[model samples]
Target: MYVVIFKAKVRQFDDQYSQTANRMRELALTEFGCLEFNAVTEGDLEIALSYWPSEEHIKAWKQHPEHLAAQQLGKQRWYESYSVEVVEIKRSYKSGSY
Candidate 1:
């Protein structure tokens, strides 16, 4: 498994941001093979974690047209700054099933 960590400094959000975000999440899960997606915001900070099966899937998602548009909008309006990190999960332990 792989995880993409997206940390952002929010500038502002509008209704379009919410709709686009939802659509993006759906598309990632349905079309890009995303295992899971989660996000949270507090104060001016936002963090999103998306799980994936492979780097190839992540690359395809990053270059997706709708995602590209959303990224442009985020840079122009929704976010002040952001960082993304992709990491491999080498091992795991779980106490219970979700």
Candidate 2:
């Protein structure tokens, strides 16, 4: 498994940003090979973590047209700054049954 960690400092957000983000999340799950996604916001900061099956899947997601547009919009309007990291997951564990 692989993980994509995205951290951003929000700038300004409007209704369009919410719609776009929801659409993108749906695409990540349905179109891309995203296993799981979680995002949280605190103050002006946001962090999103997504799990994927492979780097190829991650690449495909990154190159998606709508996603590309969102990236541009994020930089241009929604986010002040952001950083993304792709890391291989050597192992993961759960304490007990969900």
Candidate 3:
């Protein structure tokens, strides 16, 4: 498994942001083979973690038209600064049951 870590310093959030976020999450999960998608915000910071099966899936997601538009909007409106990191999982551990 691989994880994409997205951390952003938010500028603001509006209704459009919420809608776009939900749409993107859905697309990632349903169309792009995302294993899991999660995001959270506190104060001015937002962090999202999306799990994927491979780099190919990640590249496909990145070039998605809607996502590309959202990235532009994020740069223009929603985020002040951001960083992304892709890392491979070397091992796994579980504690008890979910």
Candidate 4:
């Protein structure tokens, strides 16, 4: 398994950002084989994490046309700065009462 962690310092977030985020989430889960996706924002900071089965899938998702456009928009208008890290998950565990 792999996890992609994205962190950003937001410059602005308008209705377009919200709508595009919702659409991208749907596209990622339904079309990009994203196993899990999570995002949070506080003040100017935003973080998003997504899990994937393989690096190929991650690369594919990164190159997706819609995602590419979003990236450009982030650079141009929405994000002041951002970083992405892709890590291999060697082990994972969860324990709780369902």
Candidate 5:
């Protein structure tokens, strides 16, 4: 499994951001083969983690038209700065199943 971690400093958020974010999450899961997606924000900081089966899926999601538009808007208005990291899972252990 692969994980994409997106950490950022938020700027502004409103209805449009909410709608786009939900839509993008759906697209990533249903269309791009994302295994799981989670995100959280506190104060001015935001962090999102998306799990994938392959890097190709992540690349495709990054280039998706709607996602590209959202990225542009993020840079223009939604986020102040961001960093993305892609990592491979080496091992995993879960204490409980949900």
Candidate 6:
């Protein structure tokens, strides 16, 4: 499994940002090989984590038109700065009740 971690320092988040975020999450889960998607915001910081089956899917997601637009918007308005990391998951363990 591959994990993509995205961290951003938010400059602003308006209604459009919220709509775009929700759309992207939905598209990723439905159209791509996205296993899990998670996001959280606190103060000026926002963090998102997504699990993918391979790097190809990540590349495809990056070049998706809607996502590209969102990236540009982030640069122009929503985010002050952002960083993304792709890492290989060596192992994972979980035991809980949902």
lDDT by residue (tens digit), candidate 1, 1-98: 99999999999999999999999999999999999999999999999999999999999999999999999999999999999999999997888786
Error of 3 at 51 (Å): 0.2
Candidate 2 C-alpha lDDT tens digits along 65-94: 999999999999999999999999998988
Off by over 4 Å in 2: none
Candidate 3 lDDT by residue in tens digits, 15-46: 99999999999999999999999999999999
Clashing pairs in 3: none
Compute each candidate's TM-score over C-alphas: 0.97, 0.97, 0.97, 0.96, 0.97, 0.97
**How do the residues 40-92 of candidate 5 rate in per-residue lDDT, one tens digit apiece?**
99999999999999999999999999999999999999999999999999997
The global C-alpha lDDT for each of the candidates, from Candidate 1 onward, is: 0.98, 0.96, 0.98, 0.95, 0.95, 0.96
RMSD of each: 0.7, 0.8, 0.7, 1.1, 0.7, 0.8
| Candidates 3 and 4 compared by TM-score, better number | 3
Q: What residue pairs clash in candidate 6, if any at all?
A: none
Which portions of model 5 miss their true places by more than 4 Å? none
lDDT of 2 at 95: 86
Name the regions of candidate 6 deviating beyond 4 angstroms. Answer: none
When summed lDDT is taken over every stretch of 10 residues in candidate 5, the lowest stretch is 89-98
User: How badly does each model clash, as a count of residue pairs?
Assistant: 0, 0, 0, 0, 0, 0
Which structure is stronger by lDDT: 1 or 6? 1
| Candidate 4 deviant stretches above 4 angstroms | none
Candidate 6, residues 1-98, lDDT tens digits: the string is: 99999999999999999999999999999999899999999999999999999999999999999999999999999999999999999998888963
